[model samples]
Target: MHLEETETMHRKITDGVYYVGVDDHHTALFENLWPLPFGVSYNSYLVVDDKIAVIDTVKNIFTQEWLDNIREIVDPEKIDYIVLNHMEPDHTGALPKIAELAKNATIVFTQKAAGMEESFYNVGLKTKVVEDLEELSLGKKTLKFVHVQFVHWPETMATYLAEDEVLFSCDAFGSFGALNGKHFDDEIDMRMIESESKRYLSTIITSYFKFVQRAIEKVKGLGVGIKFIAPSHGPIYRKDPTWVIDHFDKWSSPELDKHVTIIFGSMYGYNLRLAHTLKKELVELGVEVKIHNISYSTMDNVITDAVRAGVIVLGTPTYDAFPFPKIWAFVNEMEGKRFQKRPIALFGTHGWGGGGVRKLKKYLEENKFEILEPNVRCRATPTEEERQAIKTLAKNIAEIVK
Candidate 1:
């Protein structure tokens, strides 16, 4: 019904701002690729200032629920501003409908949104373009729009509230899981959210890492203090905003985790043995290690570990003169993400020939990976020398992970 009447919805954030967002518990896939087993949340906010301002809109499918959230705070017709941080359908799919609800609401976004507004929304925009460091006052509260291009989209921006020290980040610190009841990061189980947050960053924000780095730097460069990060997705960061910011900076930067990831595919268990052996060796060397059997794990899961790991060891058997199909698929996906420069250790079992190993070497080399010394090719089984070779490879891999 309405926010004022309902007790379960519309959690308050600070005195003036309230969380007017909805959760999609049924959506199986996000962006039509990544699985959303925990579902996802499309976070919207309501600022009850001298003039009511609504920050971002939700998907068209959730229009009524969203409108109900808005109605709980202030009348939709009384809303004065609708701030759009990103033009993705998830955030703007209901723009036309919302525009109808708040006929006098002004659409505020970055200048880049000008060229693509009509093309994406197909509705005439009553718009005001914000500059690099633009500011607007809604009486006592102030809103600042900072452009963060390629944080998944070119027209992306983040809205900052100077009075409350809250940053309404578009999707910078967002995760994939729906907020079942937990709205803030401190309110939920941090351990459960950590993995989903990493998956979100690795899947959605991995491609634009350079911009992600630049965006964080640019926002911090502004010198405006950020106390709470109310992103348009997932939980808001109120307990410690720096925790998420630090997480973003660490993940977006080139400095990866000091860990080893072993992605392997085996035809007859020889390559499997090689993978486990390397895992044991790396663990003994005090380096964190994660292993994935490609046959059982998805490519997304493999990429999740490999991207953050400083060293990647691929173990697979030759099949039809190429690396195992699953392993090939995994590498191909990582290649699409432009993975490069990390130390790669390759070892596998080949039945009759060594063409698969050579091809893998060339592929990684082409991608400019730093090839470790002695990438051994086991002949269908682990020999005494092959076992020692793997041990040496493990030591080398641990050394480079810093």
Candidate 2:
């Protein structure tokens, strides 16, 4: 590997590879669902050899910026192959523009992505469908494709540069944060990256966790040394690539942390008081607890904590004879994500009617969550007996987690 002074615009990965990705700071939400408090990045790579190849393209909105980044390295028309690792718009929205400019470039992707290419852009240009473990020689550099289906999408695959030992993992190891000129993992605050990565995993890829585990095992089975992991989002893992890999393995595994997450929707502070009381009991019992008010907290954060915790507790005030709207919405979201089953405790308050706790209990049980004993329900405020029941509920949860 050779070192060169970093250019003001693009940074070099090694002698021939370059980072041509773009940062997105304007989009307030990721996929129009998850909040983007730290923004996000769309990473693309350019491999310069005897035959130049562009790994991926950024979102259409950042076409000019992406083009300018590549133009600084080589003429767009000189690109020999445009590798489509994933068909998601965030990574392929600029494909049509690049294909138009690079008239001679042939689109290279897996057999599955070939059909998606036409559906997405229909550029009608030349294309090459490669098989898994197939290698494409670009003079001095050799690129190998590994099929890792359903890392989040069935058509997803990762490219490996044997010479440089860099894995161009599309979304398999991605996070939700912009590089902001800090492209390497060691250059930024990793604590923030780990948290955001967990949130990303829970929101985007948790449903396909089994696939994630298989992908990780397959990549490891390849027995290739990985010098860097360049994903389509967030920073490149150069310092400790295994850190991200191991974290993904653990997050996808069915193991839970010894902690509790309490999510509540309180109307007029009745259920809110119950949530606090439960928290106090759990804390005095030496069990860690995370409390979230669904009314204001984003679903992304709540899900992140919920996925990590060993025990889950819900408190909602009855609304229209059902669980509170926000709490009900959260439960639906968790159901879609298909989180690992854990012990759950339910508590709620009602005025004239009392069906909220019952409905919640049934739904949670149907979803495979083990219901803890003493499912507490009360009137507008908790009575002395209900308070005792809440404490008992907390004790049972702590015992299970411990």
Candidate 1 pairs with clashing backbones: 3-72
Tens-place lDDT digits, model 2, residues 1-402: 212323225778889999999889889998899999999999999999999999989899999998888989999999999999989999999999998899988999888898999888999879999898899999999999998899768988999999999999989889998888888999999998999899898888978889999999999999999999999998899999999999999988887889899999997999998899999999999999999999999999998888878988999888999999999998898788887888889999999867899999999998888999999999977788888898889889989888
Per lDDT, the best of the predicted structures is 2
Which of the numbered candidates is closest to the native, going by highest TM-score? Answer: 2
List the global CA lDDT of all models.
0.85, 0.90
* Candidate 1 ranges with C-alpha deviation above 4 Å: 1-8
TM-score versus the correct structure, for each prediction: 0.93, 0.96
Worst 10 residues of 2 by lDDT: 1-10
- For candidate 1, the 10 contiguous residues with the lowest summed lDDT are 1-10
lDDT of model 2 at position 358: 94
Error of 2 at 118 (Å): 1.4
